[model samples]
Target: MIITKAKPIEEILPFLEGKERIFLVGCNVCAAKMKTGGEPEVLALFDYLTGLDYNVIGWAVPTAACSVRSYESLVEKNEKLKEADCVLVMACGSGTSVIASILDLPVTGTNDTLSLGGQIGSSAINHLCSLCGDCNIGDYSGICPNACCPKSQINGPCGGSKNGMCEVSKTSECVWYIIEKRMKTVQTLPILNKIKPPKDHFV
Candidate 1:
């Protein structure tokens, strides 16, 4: 899933400075899960903007704000959108870009795209993939040092690691340590014998 966080109100306020008719768009998937751009959030923003004397024509919490089909569906049915001079998108940067591309009016986002992550039970795990063209996650039992490690240490941990924690940050568990533990658990310790080469950044 794509992780997202709300932008400060101060930043969003500037985008609405002179806009009168406003149409708000929210994401129902990732942003909804994160409580950033859910239906509740859209309604809250709608009321807040209405209280400020702005005419909020309409709002929609699309199934996925990133989909062109979603916005097309909205445009087909929501006549209120046609009256708006600008759109406020409560979703990730990708969603904002999609809206901007489809709409002729000015479009702005309320959320900042954080990272690609997944849910581990109730916990949200981030930095799972760096999106490097070259993937060698299979070698480390599905752990990618390029993304999990602050230093991007592929072969092993830096000498500064202590107590299974990264030297760069006391709060972070050393990725190499996690990789070693995972390798041992799967009886693939011999895989560690093979050295990994430097990452090809050009890819």
Candidate 2:
């Protein structure tokens, strides 16, 4: 799932400065799961904007605002959207961009895209994969050194890690250290001996 954080009101105010007849679009998937742009959130924002003397024409929480077809369907079904002079999308950057591309009016996002991560108990965790096109996590006990390591070290630790912590960020544990420990626990430490080819950044 894509992780996202809601933008503060101070930042969102600027986008609505001279705009009236606003329409809000929220996502029921990633944004909803994060409690950023769910149905309740969109309605609360609608009331807040109304109290501030802004004419909030309508609001909709689509199944997935990132989908062009879903958003287009909502737009076609809701005639009030045609009256909107501005659109405030409470989804990720991709959803906002897709809406903006489909609409002639000004479109803005109310959330900041954090990362392509997943939900873990009540928190979100960033994945080790950076989507580098060449996946080799299977060779390293399902951990990708390209993303977890600050230096993107694929072969092994840079020898700068001490006490299992990274030299670059003393507070964060070295991913290589975690990988090694995990491999040891699984009795697969010998797999680390295989040389990994350098990542093809162009991919």
Candidate 3:
């Protein structure tokens, strides 16, 4: 799932100014799971906009907002999508791009894309795999400190790791401790002790 956070209404309202007829598009996949761009969220935003005297033309919360073909099909079926002065996509940043690509209208994003999610728990999802396009999981004992750690230290933990929790985020577990514990259990502790050179990004 692609985790997302709702942009504050204050920021959204400013961008929406001077745009009378507005169309809303919400995602039913990742954004819906986060409760930021689902059907309920779209209707909630619709009601809010109606209260603010914004002429909302129409809205749609489809199953996949990132699919360009699906979006074009949706637009073909719903004339309101093309009739609106501006489109406010209630999904991730990529959903906005999908809408803009199909429609010639002024399209923009409502929710801010956060990260590729491993678990859907909080408004900000817990991330495990960053999809860095590099597979170094074996070296890190299947734990990615470089992705979860604020410091992004590939080698090991920094001085900030104390009491098995990260200094940056107290709720976050210390990644180095997790890696070492995992390595020891697998009898790969000796391999972990070996120093590694910098990652070759070209690879």
What does candidate 3's lDDT look like per residue over 1-203, in tens digits? 88888999988988788997899999998888888899999999999999989999899987878875854588776778767889899888787788788877788899988777755355454566667777677887777765777887788889988988888888978878888899889888787777777656576
- The lDDT of model 2 is 0.87
Write down the worst ten-residue block by lDDT for model 1. Answer: 68-77
* lDDT tens readout by residue for model 2, 83-112: 999999999998888788888999999999
Model 1 misplacement above 4 A: none
Say what the RMSD of model 3 is: 2.5
Question: Candidate 1 residues 1-203, lDDT tens each?
Answer: 77888998889989998898999999999889888999999999999989988889999888888986744677886788988999999998898998888889999999988777777876778888887888999999998899899898998999999999999988989999999999999998799899989989898
Ranking by lDDT: 1, 2, 3
192: Cα error in model 3, Å: 2.1
Poorest lDDT segment (10 consecutive residues) of candidate 2: 68-77
State TM-scores per candidate: 0.90, 0.87, 0.87
Off by over 4 Å in 3: 120-125, 185-188, 200-203
Error of 1 at 63 (Å): 1.1
* Residue 112 lDDT in candidate 2: 94
Question: Model 2 off-target regions past 4 Å?
Answer: 70-72
Q: Which one is best on TM-score?
A: 1
**Model 3 TM-score relative to the real fold:** 0.87
